[model samples]
Target chain A: MESAIPLHLETPRTRHKRVPDDYQPPYPSFVARYKPSVNRVVMAYFGLQYRGTAAAAATDALAEIAARFAAEGGPSHWDRAQYVDQAGYENVVSVAYWDDIARFDKWFASAREAWTGAQPEGIGTFIEVLRPTVARHETLFSSLGRPEGVAAISGGMSGEVQEHAYWGGMRDRIPLSQTGPMSPGGNPELIRDGARLRVKAHDNLCLIRSGQDWSDTETSERKLYLDDVEPVLREGMDFLRDDGLGIGCYANRYMRVLAAGGDASEKSYGQSWWKSLAALERWAESHPSHVRIFGAAMKYLSTLGPSAKLRLYHEVTVAAADEQFFEYLNCHAKTGMLAAVETVAA
Target chain B: MESAIPLHLETPRTRHKRVPDDYQPPYPSFVARYKPSVNRVVMAYFGLQYRGTAAAAATDALAEIAARFAAEGGPSHWDRAQYVDQAGYENVVSVAYWDDIARFDKWFASAREAWTGAQPEGIGTFIEVLRPTVARHETLFSSLGRPEGVAAISGGMSGEVQEHAYWGGMRDRIPLSQTGPMSPGGNPELIRDGARLRVKAHDNLCLIRSGQDWSDTETSERKLYLDDVEPVLREGMDFLRDDGLGIGCYANRYMRVLAAGGDASEKSYGQSWWKSLAALERWAESHPSHVRIFGAAMKYLSTLGPSAKLRLYHEVTVAAADEQFFEYLNCHAKTGMLAAVETVAA
Candidate 1:
């Protein structure tokens, strides 16, 4: 939650990895861009694999939480997913994007009421956080109004820049500001009064991934889905969403791999963002949702015998929210990294 | 939860089904009994099918709850099980038996703190309840002390008349008496001041059955456990527990079927008790858990290409608490049906 040490310090938090020239877009589909007026971006996934009556409770809980978000205008972009896969385990997840870390923090603390309620008892759920910068991360979204993740709050912009791969090579993408001398180079005296974007020393970003697609029926892939996968992924998703909110998660989405690229076709992916590593780990290790879910899994594996198809995976990454450069090209105003292009580049 | 109707009125409740002559002890294992002096008994199972981090969370939650129960001095007997199957799915469950419905009722409410806390975003959770009487119900507990369900509170008794069944021959395990003429052979004067156990007129009992094992995977018994069934099962259980509670369900449990007599080896059952059929039906029909669980099952059936192994079944029974018979043999001092037999009969 607190800054992961300042960017000026020499640590993993400040380490900047230049984007690889061989890096192709992570998605096979066309991707849209969003720009917003914030130094940080947060993405998350809320998903579960379920059956029985509790599935409905999960959905109801999600609907209730969604309603709460809609009322509070919690995230800039919030999207729903029916059935999502976590490794081999089947699940449902929602992807949400937040432009303001402060707003996200505030919402996370006081919004307990949105998640406080009764839900079915056996669904498995967790939150994942992925902190992507313009350089290391790429996304593709449909133009359909169902804008997921960060696309909902972005506006259009275009420009180009040579330096700072972290800025992602948009035409006029620019950085938000913080006090003190900016990184890479000292403040541009010429741009001090100009519209140049700014940067902070210790902006923190996080990446989280967690979900299960198969359970006891995990020994064989075909039988896994045939026996364990829920035919209606949405039912499970709704159950998860309703229950997901009860535990604190900044934002999460259940994603189907329409284009697996090199990955398995049946595999589903989830993306989530959290304020810090501590917050994310605490929920995973100590919370009831995770504890009960994994507990059942261990018991299932022990009772039902070998299950090779069911699997769970996760990755965590943290970085400075704003890097040293920005370039907004054919992007929107609400998108992170280019959200305030005009205000900064001018 | 009020009673369905007054006990004085002639209804199905007042009707007694004499123990059948063909009846036999319900289990292959030897069973002991406890003679608690309470008319109404409450039993439940907390189970989930989960994997990865989520399973741990479920266990943690349960552990926390068990600790709370231990702290609160809950139930006469509370036990734990792992890899228990309910129907076809797999999970771990904690079976609890309460001798006093009044104490159970008190614990259900006002004990919110025990369940309140931060959990992961998506882990389906649910509660189920079932009501059964001596005639229709039977159990066997291992000498290992892992007492479950009704067996947790029952005691042994051997003295019997040729007319009574091992199912306690309580002259009226008869539904607990209301403030009226009692039941079929109403004669309050015979034992006006006897220290007999009593039950509330409207005290409701629920029977919930869920969780799957090899049934959904039975087409290829080898493939059953190979496929992931825990996710959906957990999802399903949570949906039921959450939605069930929202409705009139008093409690529920996810059970592992250790033995099913003549049935296939892999089968688990759930038990949930409800205040009234109407209350249960309302929640089942309109609540999110039932709708979504069934919907998910339908979708799962539709998607997996073949769902022959998957099956869902449940039974419902409503009855008065005290039965029409009671026989006190050599049993412990805490069994239901005759909690204070010595005190009352003396």
Candidate 2:
């Protein structure tokens, strides 16, 4: 594995996170581990939107979809929750994870046919899916718990990793980033026919899901979070949502993770799309918004020390154009990847 | 106003929306008309966030700020609303409009001194302001009532505008876009000292605040919106928030407008930041998410005919680097323009 390149060689740009020779992380963090045989994973979001009057119909639709997933040849792991969207519409979203794209492909065919075949009136249904290779994905968690998102399908969590608790740590965690800078290539293109729209993604399109869980915090810690930290976090999220183009963020959503009964839970997360891993890294490392977030988080963690019950985690993926699939049926023009690409008549 | 350029001349790219010579709008839409003497205006968002326990403190703070505005030198008009942010924290936001920046400057000095001097414990405060020249701003409305945002500072609504019901109409509506392609010219730079961070913005950074109001909708129209249009709109907004990089959107927020008592009102909006007007136009003209939004709106409007009560409006501004100012005090790293630029030690 030895290379001819010298250790002292300095390139104009570095592909990996640079820390001072004596730099050490303030706290230990863990990275999700996957089996060597697992090369690609599929993350799919099945969303169903309904009005209050159509609750029964929406429930029936969701039940049918759940039944299919429970049948043979389904995803390896799946979770569902209910929430109210920004427009105050009731929505039930099911997230499914599959370690093997082939198995997902097999299950998706039947699921798509059954779901699209029966179009329930007064309900909005959509499927947004992504398949990223192992090298293109990265994950970090502050503490161990039942892993969420892509981690649910992972083999286990790694012991404390050395790459975290500092700027550029996220990029340094991504395996692909070690070999080359994941720069975006080409542009997203959309094909439309009638009510259906499909968006073809571009190379190195980056997606990040940064989450927080104060559901298990003590009363004092909860107050500290609600009073001191959460407001700062919301400010950052709002900034990203309203004015985040100059630094390379495309879109951002600060979503409340809802309970099964559709009540706002103690958990929430920010989902964002970036032009490339570099753009995201730039913002995280140097943007004032991120700096403020880091400062507040550090202060909070230090104040509570080991007794801090609040949990934080994130997953970032840079998907190749061919690895992404975005389609909408009877959905709005701004759904998912549709807003990032040009649409043309099929 | 006559120029050497011929009418039939076709440039490499067009700065305005293009429609067939015989094209007629499906429905009439109006643009806000500013007084001839008014060449610029300032929009400021004064926000106060507090926990439930600090409601009284927040109220007092709001009263103090409002009192200042009501005094001798102040904004031309102002409106207030209370809403819950994504983090479940209560926020009271006051939007003030000033036709003159110098007048705002005069008021802001005292306001800043008074507001910042008193750091009310347990309450988080911030100010986000934008000043754009008349040529750099544009506004449109399906039907006007008490106009919101920048329109609140305008003279009145124009008669049925020619640019409506067509792709690229937004660009055509912008007075500056008629002459020049509003492209970004520089990168955002930041300077930080302790808890304070200041961001210098780039040229032609586009800002859009697109709003929807169904507050006065009849039962049937309200149902039509909730059942059909709203879901689609949420999908589009979510798309922009979660995945809007490839088409040039930097950030997008789908926010619910709240009542005076912090209850959700029958109004919402999508506020987004884009790299340039051209990028925005491209998305509006051909992106699937926007296409779906336009389709749904047209269907709703046509279905309800002239009796439709759902109101829609948007304001777009392409600000020069010097025209924009971003500053944060004891704020998180990801606040406002902070997320869109680099931060350096002051």
Candidate 3:
């Protein structure tokens, strides 16, 4: 496999992690667009916990995933676990760029045997996926090698890597662009509308990340990345990509800047929608995918010999309707969490 | 632990498995009875499946269960797996004699923590418990080790173990005994009147027995029983014992005959009840306890080298009320699968 076809971006200060407090984004937040051939992005965060025996299966699954990605005209774009280290969980969060959601869907629907066999029973596997335009989602990163996640996967991303100082300055310049969906009812020019919108009671907000200074060159660590990492990411993406399974979840996206480098991002967050808080809790604790991912993580972490930088943390957030803000700008059709909120749209 | 305290029944011919085709009990249909001390019997069937990784957990849990019984005064009378073996599963179905359901309930309610820790996430643990009197449920076999299931757990039972040939002769001499609850309505008459009685649609019937010639005292077999079997079994029993957690299950009881020797009870059956088929299915496929039991078995099975006489099979039965038959003799009140059924004293 060669980065020759199109490494697209120039590498800068060796793509490093930025402690959250010290981090800033230099790029203007806008509705991102892909090249003519690129139409959608597949993002995922596959995590691991360090305690149990099931975790090993996760790493093994990951390796199988990476190999698959590397084979035959694979994903147009892909990234590894470059996200910051949060306290609770170690995860492999990445993105794959594709021109058509259908092609990606086709592979997912047909490629069962190609990935890890029946998800390990003891492990936990939690996943999320999204196909949002630049206007629907926004991201920020500092000093990354070329582009990563959605930005990297999309062919037309301005491949320039910037410094932390540059990010600090850029933050003040770019007010966030619209990230919600284009309401079918058109724009609302309400000042003090008589009708009061009811705020919903449920939301799913997750901040997940791995340990500090944890990435090492040890044989196992390398194996974690090269073998187990990619396939697992693919599995997660495939999981969320399937429309049939995304029951309560509206949108699933993983942003590199949001997931990476900074200590703030070390405990990165996942923003998704659910019909109810109870529904979200159920999925979190017992969903097959979630349990499997958790199990695999535990198994893998257990093998790492203690003292290996490792702590995975999560602060789940459930919110009300009024508490969330989502919108889209000069972008295309449905996008973001709000697009799936039927009540608002109706 | 000493059998001196009215060890009750006599052991006959080292209770062993009888292949389905070869099994034939000659006693004319009759309900069994225990001495005055016997109030109810707790019967159970624990089984295994040979192919998967979780099978090891099943055997291990069984061993743990057997030890628990042996260490504590043991069941008043219990039998090793001796029921006829059908194709498909290996099971240990045995009974424990309980003079007072209260004592049994006390042990169950308080003895939870002493069992296995949080149920293993990978193994599959399924169990069934019945507290029935001699009138409600009857057992007829060629020979069985004394002290099986609830029969052994209780205070006293007839100290006679007879061969089927002897049973065949005994049948012509002994007439049918009472096999119904003492009616509060004070009528032996109501039952026999030729009035069409409606049969209920909800019922659960189980016939679990282990496989034939499947157990081998090989290294793998010993390791499996010692390491994986006990823990898995303990976990499952613990899971159901927890008042806060045993959601849909009514009761759980496991005895050696239902889980012991004779082909590892490879074709054991699990007889239990649920509010509905859907509820039972949900627990079987997704509950943490069930999954963990399955996983442990798989892991344990995978590790065993070949030449291990291992076979685990099961056919879980959920029946409609009319399809199941149960009764309570002059023995006690509120026992058997049909506990809610009205008691009628004959």
Measured against the native two-chain assembly using Cα atoms, what DockQ does each of the candidate structures obtain, in the order listed? 0.01, 0.01, 0.00
> Is 2 or 3 the stronger prediction by DockQ?
2
Error of 1 at A67 (Å): 88
Cα lDDT tens digits, model 1, B53-117, are 56667767666657656756476776555543223233455556676766766775533323322
Query: Evaluated with TM-score, which candidate comes out highest?
Result: 2
Q: Give the per-residue lDDT digits (tens) of candidate 2, residues A1-346.
A: 1111212222333232333233345567787788777889888878776779888988788888888878877887776765554456676767788998888898899897666445667777767777998878888888887587788889788776766654456666676655566778876777765566666667998988888989999889999999999998988887776667655676666777766665678888887778777677656633557655765776788789988999999989999888877666655443455556554324
Write down the worst ten-residue block by lDDT for model 3 chain B.
B178-187
- For candidate 1, write residues A289-336 as lDDT tens digits: 443333444334444443244444333344454422222221122222
Candidate 2 scores an iRMS of: 19.1
Note the Cα lDDT for every prediction shown.
0.38, 0.70, 0.35
Q: Looking at candidate 2, what is the lDDT of residue B239?
A: 77
Residue A260 shift from truth in candidate 2, angstroms? 5.5
lDDT of 2 by residue, B36-127 (tens): 77878987777676789988888898888888889877888876665454455666667788998888888898787565444567676667
What's every prediction's RMSD, in angstroms? 26.3, 18.3, 25.6
Interface RMSD of each: 30.9, 19.1, 28.8
Give the candidate number with the greatest lDDT. Answer: 2
Q: Kindly report the docking quality category of candidate 1.
A: incorrect
Candidate 3 per-residue lDDT over residues A228-293, each given as its tens digit: 543453344335323312444544433232232323342222334444332333344344454455
lDDT: which is higher, 1 or 3? Answer: 1
